[model samples]
Target: MPKITYIEHNGTEHVVEVPVGLTVMEGARDNNIPGIEADCGGACACSTCHVYIDPAWVEKLPAKEDMEEDMLDFAYQPDPARSRLTCQIKVTEDMEGLVVQMPEKQI
Candidate 1:
């Protein structure tokens, strides 16, 4: 399992032990962490699960695919350099200690 840290807009942090195969959005939801709506159930069709990867971990993630990039257009405050759909990020062993920040709004 990998541990992922989710920071809310107010600086609240939730550190969850996520299984290696689950998506980041699923990890947050399963652990009762707020801010990740995942309205589309981990599909790339929605932006409610949008989050900002911590600067240090940004380069460790895979490049965004076309669908993810298009969906981000609907995120609350899109930052191309950091905004990513949590559903698209898989929890891998190498992602241990990964940190992601939630946006102020999800709609």
Candidate 2:
């Protein structure tokens, strides 16, 4: 399992271990983390699971696909260089130290 750190907008953090093959949004949802809503159930159809990747981890994640990029247009405040839709990122051992910060609010 890879450990993922989810940070809330208010600066609180939750570090949880997610099994390999699960999506990042699923890790948050399963652990009851407060930030990622996952409204589309990992379908990449909504921006509610939007988050900002920690600067150091930004280049480590897979590039966003067209669908995820389009949906992020509806997120609260997306950063072109850091914003990512959690549902699109599958967990793997290489992401053990991954960190993601929630926006102030989701759309």
Candidate 3:
């Protein structure tokens, strides 16, 4: 399991251990973390699972695919440099210590 940190807009932090092969959204969902809704259930069909990757971890994550980039347009407050759909970020050993911050709201 790899540990991931999810920070709410108000600054609450939840650090969780996620199994490899699951998406970052799944980790948050399973832990009852409130920030990511994952409304499309990891299908890349909605922007509900949006979060801002911490600047330190941005370049470490996989680059966004066209589908993810497109869906992010619908997110509430997207930052081109850090915004990402958690559903598209699969957990891996290399992702340990990954940190993400939730937006003010999901749209």
Candidate 4:
């Protein structure tokens, strides 16, 4: 399992241990962390799971695919350098201590 820290817009943090292979979106939902709506249930079709990866951990994640990049266009406040759909970030052992900050809104 890998531990992920989700920080809300207000600076509240929720640390959760997520099983490898699960998406970060799933981890947040399973942990009952707020601000990750995951309205599409892990599907890459929506931006409700938008989050900004901590700069320190950004390079560790795989590059976003075309679908993910397109969906990000719909995110509330997308940041090309940091915004990502949580559903596209799969958990891995090396991802322990990963941190992501939720956007102020998700649409």
Go through the candidates in order and give each one's C-alpha lDDT. 0.94, 0.94, 0.96, 0.95
lDDT of 3: 0.96
* Per-residue C-alpha lDDT of model 3 across residues 1-107, encoded as one tens digit per residue: 99999999999999999999999999999999997999889999999999999999999998999999999999998999999999999999999899999999999
Q: Listing every candidate in turn, what is its Cα RMSD in Å to the true structure after a full C-alpha superposition?
A: 0.5, 0.5, 0.5, 0.5
For model 2 the local lDDT of residue 106 reads 92
- Residue-wise lDDT of candidate 4 within 2-51, one digit each (tens)? 89999999999999899999999999999999999999899898999999
**Could you tell me every candidate's TM-score relative to the true structure?**
0.98, 0.98, 0.98, 0.98
**Residue 77, model 4: Cα distance from true site in angstroms:** 0.9
Error of 3 at 107 (Å): 0.6
> Where does candidate 3 stray beyond 4 Å?
none
Error of 2 at 8 (Å): 0.5
Evaluate residue 61 in candidate 1 and report its C-alpha lDDT on the 0 to 100 scale.
94
Model 2 TM-score (2 dp):
0.98
lDDT score at residue 56, model 3, on the 0-100 scale: 97
Superposed by TM-score, candidate 1 places the C-alpha of residue 56 at a distance from the truth, in angstroms, of: 0.4
**TM-score of predicted model 1?**
0.98
